[model samples]
Target: MSDAEAARALAEGHLVILPTETVYGLAADAGNAVAVAAIFEAKGRPRFNPLIAHVADAVQAEAIAVFDARARALAEAFWPGPLTIVAPVRDRDRVCDLARAGLDSVAVRVPGHARARAVIAAFGGPVVAPSANRSGRPSPTTFADAVEETGAFAAAALDGGDCAVGVESTVVSVLDGRVSLLRPGSVTREEIEAVVGPLDRDGEGHRSPGRMALHYAPDAPVRIDVVEPRPDEILLGFGPGVGALRWSLSPSGDLREAAANLFRRLREADREQPAGIAVSPIPAQGLGEAINDRLRRAAGFVG
Candidate 1:
């Protein structure tokens, strides 16, 4: 279906597979109860796990939540980008609570993709979206992945090509004047620290969506390969190997590129339905941490 039509469907409480700078999101009108519920149903996602609300601008974001001066500053610095900041839902709780699973806090961001902005502007409300796929599967970077999960619910999917950034947004929650890294994503801890200063570093054990030790996982068992590909395993972040399927993170070793391609590659391997998948080891630091986080999740760690 057309993007405008998809936007219309979403505004009318239907699901649409929409593009984001990071990945395709299973999007719904965040202001519509039935629409938001459909997103949960589409992914078989637990109610307690919240979705990130997307907007076109700061004004739109502020209308849905209470964003103090700090938030405003960050919005000015990062909006039209891949950065999700947790804020009080306030008036938007009426519509967003269903997306947030009754949490007082709402995850919100203004994606950098032009298509995403276009869709949000067309709908004229918060669009609470999560990665478009079954809850435990690797998030989709293309329309093909969305169709695999729910073709009926995704009446329309905007073809914005593949997502530019394959990883999720960096999520930070400012608490008692301290910034906490709720999720390590496209934006790194170092980058965030540069902007927000030394973080409180919640360091896991936090009740947050992406924080679950196990998240962004596929149903197939995952094993990380530090040396070479194993015969029976589908190798990810490498190239095709004789006995094993090869997938490489980034031949150039670009963390951001690897992050962008991470899920797409994992999902490709999953389509093969190998008994298990083995990931090649990425650097333990930098975006490698972000990449490893997703691998660990696929290996069965909860956020």
Candidate 2:
């Protein structure tokens, strides 16, 4: 659909799947309660977790959030890119409580894709979007993935191509002037600290949409064979056990390359459904954290 066509549909309060620097997001008019509800319904998402509203820039984000100097500073440094900042509600009474799950805060970001920015400019209001997939499923990097999973929703989607980041944004919550790392993504904690100073990790307050104990899981049963998984199990290389198990991330233990290849590996492994999958623990560093993060979530890693 044309940008105008998409905007019109969104104007009438409909859901849309749009690409961002991080992942493809199913978007809806954040200002319209009806439109936003459709996103949760379409994805079978619960109302307890709030949605991240996407805007073009500070001007738009300010309309929806009460940004402090820290929030604004971080936005100037990392926004129009892949950083999601949590802050106190802007015009508290004005923002729909449904979007925040009745929390006193909201997660907002300015997407870095040209097409997404254009859509925000065209749609002319904040668009609340979450990973465009059914609840508990792997997030979609391609529009076809979203279309295939969400099935048929009346809203429009911008096929702006694959998300380069291949994951979600780093989420920082600024509460009481203290920064907390709610979730980690492409932007590392070190990078965020460089911008916002040392982070004070507040415990995840509640069941945020993306903060599931078990998230980003494929529709297949998964088992991480850290040691020798099981005899009948589909084996992957750890140090020296590389057999034909349909797929393996890398018997090589290079986390940077591993991070880049994660989703692709998971999708390939999912295709086989060969008993269960095995994983080698790469040293936790740079991209390793992210790689482990996805795996932990996929493996339902708690604490």
TM-score per candidate, chains pooled:
0.91, 0.89
Shift of residue 187 alpha carbon in model 1, Å: 1.1
List, residue by residue over 1-303, the lDDT tens digit for candidate 2: 887787787788877778787778888888677777888898888788888878888898888788888888889898788788888877653346788888878788899898888888898878787988888787877777777777487467779887777777778887787887777777788888888798886645462447777877875655663755666555444333465433555556655445545665666666677566666665566655666777777878762
lDDT, residue 275, candidate 2: 67
- List candidate 2 segments past 4 Å from native: 92-95, 225-257
lDDT against the true structure, per candidate, is 0.76, 0.74
Write the residue-wise lDDT of candidate 1 on 1-303 in tens digits: 665787788867778888888878888888787888888788888887777888888888888777876777777778888888887776664346677777777778999999889888888878887888878778888777777776567778777888888888878775456567777777777877777678786532232466555678876788874456567777665433323334666666677777878888787777788888877767767777777878888888653
